[model samples]
Target: MRASASWAIRAVIAVTTVSVVAACGSGNDDGTSASPADGQKLSVVATTPEVADFVRNVGGDGVQVTQLIKPNVDPHEYEPTPADIQAIGTASVVVKNGVGMEKWLDQTIDAAGFDGTVVDTSQGVTLRKGDPDDEEMAEGDPHIWHNPLNAKIMAENIEKAFVAADSGRADTYRKNYRDYAAKLDALDAENTKKFDALPADQRKLVTNHDAFGYYIDRYRLEFVGSVIPSMDTSAELSASQLTDLVAKIKATGTKAIFSESSLPPKSAEAIAQQAGVKVVGGEDALYGDSLGTEGTPQGTYIGAEEHNTDTIVKALGG
Candidate 1:
C-alpha cells in the first residue's frame, strides 16, 4: 500500500510539471485571454497602409501590424468600422500619421477609451497650412510624407514608438529605423540636386489638389495652383475656379499638370488642355490618398518618392 501511494504521488508531480511547462510556452501565461504575445507577435495597429509599411520595416520580427485603411482608400474620409474599433482596442501600440490625417482616430479611440500608446508619426515635422483654395481644410495640411525629410522624421518617430512598446526589441527597431532614414536622406539629396538644376521659375507645380504643399515647401518649388478648390477630393471645383487656375498655370508657364492616381484624370486633362501644356500622368498620378498595390513601384514610400522624383525631374527638364 505504501509503495502504491508513493507511485501515485510521483505521477501527480509529473503531471503538474508538464502542465507548468505547457502554460509557460503556450503563450497565454497571463490571465488575459487575448493578450498579444500569445501569438509571439508585437500587436501593432496603424491608421494608414503607408504607416503600416513603415512599422513593418522597423518592427520586423515579433510584430504583427494591421492597417485601418486599405490601399486606394482616402484617409481624409475613412470611418471606423466595428471591426476596426475592436482591432484598435486590442492593439499593444497604435501608430498614426496624426496632424489630422486620420480624422477618425481621435473620436474612435475616445469612444473606445483605449489605453495603448498612440504614436503620431507626424510629430516634430512643421505642418504646412492649407491652401486658400482648400475649403475642406479647416486647419493645416496634414500630408507630410510627400517630403523625404518628413519621411525621415516619421521613421524616427516610429522607431521610438516601437522601442517604447517593446523594450526587449528596441535595438532591432533602432537599427531598422536608422537604415531606412539613411535611405531617405540619400533620396532627399538626389531630389535636391536634380531639382536644383531646374530654373527657379520652372520649378512650379500644378496639381489636382493642394496635396503637394509639403513637397513644394521642402523643395522650394512654387505651388502654382490646384485644379480642385479643396484638399478633400470629394468636393467639386467651380467653373470660375478652374478658369482662374488655368490662367494662373499659363501665367506661371507651368510645364505639367499633375493628377493623383486615385482621382479621375479627366479634370486634370481638361486643365492641361485649357492651359495648352502636357499632362504628366505616369509619374505625377502620384501616391497621396493611398499607396500603389504591393510589388508595384509606388507601393512603398521609397518607391513612391523615387517615382515622383523621376517624373518631376523629367517633366521639369532637369
Candidate 2:
C-alpha cells in the first residue's frame, strides 16, 4: 500500500511539471501570453471608403485595414461609433483625407487615446478654396481625391507612412505604390483625352454639392452650381437660393443634374425639374463622397472615377 501511494504522488508531480512547461513555451520571454494577432500584420485604420481603398492598394498583404466610414455614408456629418474608436485605439496607423474633411476625427482620436502615426493624404496637393460664406468649408475643399493626380500624391504619402511604420516591408509598399500610381496616371490621361475631345460648352457640370471642385478643375469643366449651396450636405437650401440656382442652371444651359450616391437625390431632381433637365440618380449617380459597394465595379476608386466620367460624358452629349 505504501509503494502504490508513492507512485500515485510521483504521477501527479510529473503531469503538473509537463503542464507548466507547455504553458511557459506558449508565452514570450517577458512572460506575457501570445495573442492570435500578434506578429500577423500591421493593423491600419482608414477614415473613409476612398482612403481605405488607397491604403489597401498600397499596403496589399502587409496590412489589415479597418475602414471607419462605410461606402455611401456622408463623411461631412459622420459621427464615430464605439467600434471605430476601439479600432483606432488598437491601430498602428490611421490614414485620413485631411483638409477639413473629417470634422469628427480630432475628437475621435482623442477619445480613442491613439498615439499612432496619422497620415494626412492631402498634405502636398494644392487645395481649392471653399465657399467663404460656409464655415464648414471656410478653410478649403476636402475633395482632393477626385483628381487622379492628387490621388497619386495621396498614395505616395500613404506609401511613405507605411515604410516609416514597417521598414521591413518598404520594398513591397513602394512596388505597390508604383503599380497603382501608373494605373492612376493612365486613368487621368484617358479621362483628359475623353473630355478634351468634347466641346467646351458640353463640359459644364451641376452637381448635388460642391464635392467635385478638384475634378472640375482637373478636367477644365465649368461648374454651373450645386443643388446644396454649401459643401456640407447638412446645410439647408433657402427658397431664394434654390430659385437662383434654377435660374443659373437655365442660364448656363446645363445638360443634367448629377446627384451623389451619399446624398438624397430629391433636391437634385427638384432642381432638374425646375431647370428643365434630367436628374442622374440611382446607379448612375456620381460617387461624390464615397464609392459603391465592395466587389462592384464602382466600388473601387478607379472604377468610381470611370463611372463618373462615363455618366457625365453621356449626360452632356459628349
Candidate 3:
C-alpha cells in the first residue's frame, strides 16, 4: 500500500473515541451524547474545529456542535474513529468543508449509516484547481478557509444548514449569519489593508506547502513556491525537488517562508538553510489547516487569521 493509504489507517488512532458531551450536562464516559435540556438546541456535527467555531458564532445557543477533529489536527490525513462515526450518526446536520477536503467522510458516514443533512461550506466559492498531475484531485482544491471572502460563503452555508435542521429558528439563524458575515467582511478588509500596503514584488509567499492559494488570489499576492508542492502534507519531496525549490527561492529573492503549527517545519528549515534565508518565527506558525491549540489567541478563526496576517506582513516586510 502507498504511504497515504497507511496515513489513513494510522490516523484512526489519533482520535480514540467520540467525546459525547451533553448539551445540558457534562461529558459521558462512553461514546454517547446526553440529550439536550428540553431538546431546545440542534445537535450539529462539524468536521473541523474551525467549522465548529463558525457554528458557535452563527448557531449561538441554538446549536450544540460536536467537532470530530481536535485542535491542530490535519483533516487531509485524518481518519475518523468509531466514536467520531457514532457522533455524526446522531447529529441532525453535518457541515463539511467540502471540495474534496474530507476524503474519509463518505466511508465513515456509510459505516455509520448517517442520513443527516450535509452542508458543503465551499459552495459558491471559487476554487483553485489542483495540479493537473496530482493523483488525488487534479481539479479540486480543499483549502477554502484561507480566504476570508470564502469564509463568508461558508458561513452562509452553515447558517442554511442550521435553519434547515430547525426551521423555527430560521429568523434567528439568518440574523446570526448577517452578524457573522459582517465580522468576516471586517477581517477581509483588515487583511487587505495590510496586504495592499506591501510592494507588489514583496507579496511573493513561500511556505511549507502549496496552500494559501485562495488568500494569495484574494490579496493579489503571489504564491512563489513551497517546500512541499502539494496540499497534502503527508506527501514527501525528493532531494532534487528541495534543491530546485531552494534555487527558485534564491532566484526570486523570496525573503521569508513559513510553516504551520499543524505540520512540521523540517522541510521549510532545510529550504531556508539552502537558500540562506530565515523561516518565519512567531507566537504561532501559520494556521492554514487547523486553528491554534485551545486557550490561545490563534485558537479561534478570527484570531488565527490575525496571527497569520501579522506573520505574512512582517515576513514580507510590508
Candidate 4:
C-alpha cells in the first residue's frame, strides 16, 4: 500500500511538470509561437533589410532576426519562394514596413500559417501621397523610413512589438530603443543643418522617381519633379512625360538629376543629357528602395541616410 501511494504521487507530479513545460513553450495570444533553440531568445523575421536592422537595434541580444529580402533585390518586385516561407516558418515575431512596401507579406504569412504578430513600423509615420501618376500607390508611400523623423517613430513601434513578444525583457527593450532613437535624433539634426545651408530655390530635387517626397519635404526642399512620374522605378515612362520632366528640370533650374542606386540609371542619364543637368549616380546614387550590401559603407541605415545627404549636397551645389 505504501509503494502504490508513492507511485501514484510520482505520476501526478510528472504530468503536472509536462503540462507546465508545454505551456511555457506554447504560442502567445497574439499568434506568436516559437520553439526556441536554446530555450531562450525570440526568432524574428523582418520583411526588409531596413526593418531587419531596426529589429536588431531594438531587440539587441534578445532576438535572432531573419531578413526576408537581400541587397539589390527590390522588395517592390520580390516574390517569396518556398524556402523563404520555410525560413520564417518558426518565427515568434515578424516586422514589416507596412505602407504597402511588402505586399507579399500578409498573404505569404497567412498562407504559411505563420503564427506571429506582424509589426508594421509605419504605424505612426505620416506617409506622403503616392506620385500622381502611379495608381498602385493609392494607399500612400511606403518609404516612411526615408525621413529621419519617421525613423525615430519606427524605432518606437518596433520597440513596442519587441516588448509585447518578450515582456520578460521589457526594460532591456526600452533602453535599447532609447539609445537607438538618440542616434536617429542626432542624424536628423545633422541633416537638418546640412539642408538648411542650401538656398531654398537650390534645394529643389529632380530624382529617378517620386520617392523623395518624405525626405525633401522634411528638409524643406521643393520636389520640383522626377525623371519617372511614379514613385516606383518599375513604372513605364512615356516620351511626353520625359519631355515634360526635362522642361520641369530646366524650369526649376535643377542642377543635378539624381538616379537611384537600386534602379537602372539609363533613363535618368538620358533625361539629364536632354536637360543638360549633371547625373549624380553610381556610388553616389541615393539608396531609394533598399539598403547597401552588408558590411559596405551604405549597408547601415545611418550610413545610407548620410550617403544620400552628402551625395545630394555635393551634386546639388551644397
TM-scores across all candidates?
Answer: 0.83, 0.87, 0.88, 0.88
How well does model 4 score by local distance difference test? 0.78
lDDT of 4 by residue, 79-120 (tens): 666555654555777888987777666656654556667788
**Worst 10-residue stretch by lDDT in candidate 1?**
19-28
**RMSD of model 1, in Å?**
14.2
Question: How much lDDT does candidate 2 score?
Answer: 0.84
What ranges in model 2 sit over 4 Å off? 1-39
lDDT per model vs. reference: 0.74, 0.84, 0.78, 0.78
RMSD of each: 14.2, 14.3, 5.2, 12.7
Query: Top lDDT: which candidate number?
Result: 2
Count the clashes in each prediction.
1, 0, 0, 1
Candidate 2 residues 125-211, lDDT tens each?
Answer: 999998787776777998999999999999999999988777778899999999999999999999999898889988889998989
Question: What lDDT score goes with residue 205 in model 1?
Answer: 84
**Residue 120 lDDT in candidate 3:** 88
The TM-score measured for candidate 3 stands at: 0.88
lDDT of 3 by residue, 156-233 (tens): 999877776677778999999999999999999999999888888888888887778888888998887887778877
Q: Single out the weakest 10-residue window by summed lDDT for candidate 2.
A: 19-28
Model 3, residue 267: displacement in angstroms? 1.3
Model 1 regions more than 4 Å off:
1-39, 111-113, 131-136, 282-284
